[model samples]
Target: MLRNIVLLLLLCLIYSLEASDSDKCVTVNVNNLNDLVLKTFRPKPCMTVNINGSGKMEILSSDKFKTPLSNTPLAQVRITGGTFSIDPNFFKQYRHSLDVVTLENNNIPKLGYHVFQDLILRQLELRSNNILFLSNPFYNCSIYNLDLKHNKIDHLSDITFSYTRLFHVNLANNSISIIEPHSFPDTVITIQLSHNLLSSIGQNIFSNLFNLVLLCLAHNRLEYINFEKSDLGKLEDLDLSFNSINNLNQAGFSSLRNLKRLNLRNNHIKSISATNLQTSKLKILDISFNFFINFPHASLPESLNVIYVFGNPWNCKCLFDIEDSFSGNVVSNTMDCKLSQIVNAPICISYGGLCVDDRNNTLINAFSKEVSLYSNDCRDLLQNVIFDYEH
Candidate 1:
């Protein structure tokens, strides 16, 4: 009778490991289960399955799951550090019931095809997997937020993210160099492709993203961007900082009707006409750390609130001209730096660019001699450009 009692306790332990229940969910945790121990693992109406990829977790075969997982109403599953392949038939039951799937830290070098297709997941995070390729993985899924950061994906086919409705996507910090046109879904609101190797954008690449609000192409190898071609109508923020952009035209940003912030700091821009930035709703413009001989400050749009021009080779005559231009106009937040006449961004001048504030004290502060940012002549400007800012 004592021998029978020990066998009963062992059976209960295996049952709890394969199937357990709380106030809301029945769960199956495969923390440690071999094929021998798993044959006894009959699942019961479980809502969550946590496969931690620990202790001899091999490729998960649906036939080994004993009962048909094809009918299980799972709501959430976190499969981490596993050498598992996401087979479509394996998650046949979770097509409509799954809410979230997190598959990070798996050290996966490749994601098998047909990933999360036709799944109505609220959130899906496949970050830090060391993945090297992707195609139309989320083909027909209704994902709300998708995060695929820190991968080696280089090319995006036109149908890569062509799902039903994706709200936000972060493909930042990848080796993406080629993106085909219409690669992004129109349902997306925010898309981040920063820190990539993109040198050019395909025609009509972002023209279809009518609902896109924020598009980040920062830290790339783009030499020129013709905003008149894409004309992102609903975009609010544009970050083209840290590139090789050289010039702009009058039709550069004219169609960006709802754009508010433009970050062009740390580029190769020389001069900017006020009409080039004549968007109807622009507020802040950061053209700091560039090569500018002059800025069209006299004709700045009334819709603009602030323009940051730090770390540029502004000619001394232009600095005096800006001071003279704003004195009569409706702009005087600081006595020296008239560009920062906007109330919130008062200390706009820093890392002095132009030389000679009409007093020859070119190496002191930001705007004026008392609150200066390095004012000097051509000799001082050339020395500073070579020594300080020409990274």
Candidate 2:
């Protein structure tokens, strides 16, 4: 009876060990699983699954991830809600067709370098985040649009967008102070660098962009713009308003012959030379809120249809000439110097016959009325009278 009882206890212990082994080594057949939501999961070989995020899902399949079983990739992974921290090569083995990628409101500290190097993305939007550095995150991808607005980018290097073929790029409302001249890709057509702390534009800053159409450098601390022999042949509109530009050199705009609209408002320009508006194709010109004491009549091109010259301290001496030149024209009212003069003694509507003060008027009128009397025989008569008086 004692031997039989000891044999029964040994058999029971063997049965318990076999049950534990079978529980630890269960095969997770992933091929039949679709839209899976596991509270906690681990995967073995010969499996295919699709993950969907709900509240909190813990995945402990890091070792089995990114590894093929029998000529078949792992699984399609999709995380919709909740924060996800995916490490490098997380889903590299699977054919990733990341149609829409967004990490909005997810406070990621540092995005790993070369994380999504070989992935094909349709749209990669990381807007409204705490991303400070805007480096080459999409190194070799062909994304349609890249939106990095409302970030804390301080410096942008030239090689930042070197490899990506992005159609639209938005870098608005950042702390970007230094953009190391010509620091954009060749595929960029529309770019917004406004509302930043840029002080000056270096020469040849837009050297490589031959297809750039719209460039907004407004509302910055720019002093002057230096366009150095760039083939901006396709550039049509330019904005350089709300800055401290004193003088525009002739070479600064020699290439913008095709520009239609040019904004130089709210600047410190005293006078503009004839070489400034040499662009014959310019239709609208704004030189308002400036220190121009006179409308640059000598520099005003005949092709201009609209010109804004208000809010300047224009002297009355120069207005008479401009009014006289534009007396009977269809484009005279657009040239305004009303804000220069006081309200009561506003800019003289009519050219009062060549603007000259009373003193200048007296001298010019005296010269005009005085007759030049020619005296051919007066010299001989004066000599004869002198001879009679001496005798």
Candidate 3:
């Protein structure tokens, strides 16, 4: 009976050893994936699995994590420097506990439909890939932050992120030229679409983004904007610089009552209507390097703390009234014109020699002297006529 007990204890020890080996984190190299099924390379329960190398790996349907047989699921899976074409259900076994998945610097050409379905993934980084189109790949996932920067995606269809609760999405440095209306969820806060080929945007493209705060659309080909239809009531910062915009209407900015900073540098704008200065909460306005010949002083709101109007062909006389009507602390134009000189002359001159007269005096001075001489002659003529009538 003692001998039988010894044999049973030895069997228990072997089982415990196998269990311990199955619950440790595993690192799989693509160079050594010699006909081995992916499920046979599972790490211990609730442990991470890091897949490394640059070779291609096909994740078939039969290949899955061994976490389903155990109580704990995989914690995280990070696949770097590989061309992985994974099936939609490849991660079905670790749906409950997988929190983070990063696939950076990969050659993923496409993602299958419902690829991340039923997973509680919090963050997914798929940067620097060759993804051409963005379909509904992340269905039923509550991803908070998604990074898809430096990809080849050119368009985003409607309801692309309708199934997810995404808050921040970075789609910068892509070839995106079109965005279907309501493509983003209403819960999104910050969206970066800079350095793209977007020549124009739809009127109601951002209509549903009620919680959007920061939107970066710089380095694009946009020539005009219609914010009245965008419904960005809560947006604080808007960057539309480095575009081909030549005009701005009052209706385009009437709805942005909460906007603080507006960047319109490096455009072709020659004028800004006074009605566009209705935003009471605007603090900083950058309109540098444009074709503005006049600065609208009376139209500028008193709430503005700083304004950049440098690198434009500005009329020097426009600065006189800008310095007078504005309370000195409100308008801040970063031009080469000195406010002290402007205050003394009380005349307007163009910085680009547009106001220079033949006598080397400013056109403002010549006009002022002409008005003074004409008034004196009229008074002298009236006195002479009164003397003749009395005689």
Best by TM-score: 3
Residues 1-391 of candidate 1 have per-residue lDDT tens digits of 9999999999999888755452144455656323323533434443345555454425544554435444556677655555555555655556767787777766566665666678887788888777787756786888888889888889887778765678888898899988887888888888888788888664367878888788787778877666666747888887777667877653267778888878786677777767776677877777765666567876766676666565564565665566566554433223233333424332333335543323222321233332232223311222111011110
Tell me the TM-score of each prediction against the true structure: 0.70, 0.60, 0.73
Instruction: Go through the candidates in order and give each one's C-alpha lDDT.
Output: 0.64, 0.55, 0.67
Which structure is stronger by TM-score: 1 or 3? Answer: 3
Q: Pull out the clashing pairs in model 2.
A: 30-47, 30-48, 31-48
Sliding window of 10 residues with minimal summed lDDT for model 2: 382-391
Q: List the candidate numbers ranked by lDDT, top first.
A: 3, 1, 2
Name the runs in model 3 displaced over 4 angstroms: 1-28, 32-57, 60-72, 323-391
Against the true structure, candidate 3 has what lDDT? 0.67
Model 2: residues with Cα > 4 Å off, grouped in runs? 1-96, 105-112, 115-123, 297-303, 316-391
Residue 361 shift from truth in candidate 2, angstroms: 27
Candidate with the larger TM-score of 2 and 3:
3
lDDT of 3 by residue, 1-391 (tens): 9999999999999999988777556665543222334344434444333445446655534243332334456666666555667678767767877777777777777776888777776778888868876668878778777899999988887757768887878898999999888998887888888889998766788888888888888878998677777778888788887778887863377588888878876677777877787788987887765666576657766778777665455566665455566656545453333322333322334556443222223443443444344435432221110000100
lDDT of 2: 0.55
Give candidate 1's error at residue 205 in angstroms: 1.4
Give the candidates in order of TM-score, highest first. Answer: 3, 1, 2
What TM value does model 3 have? 0.73
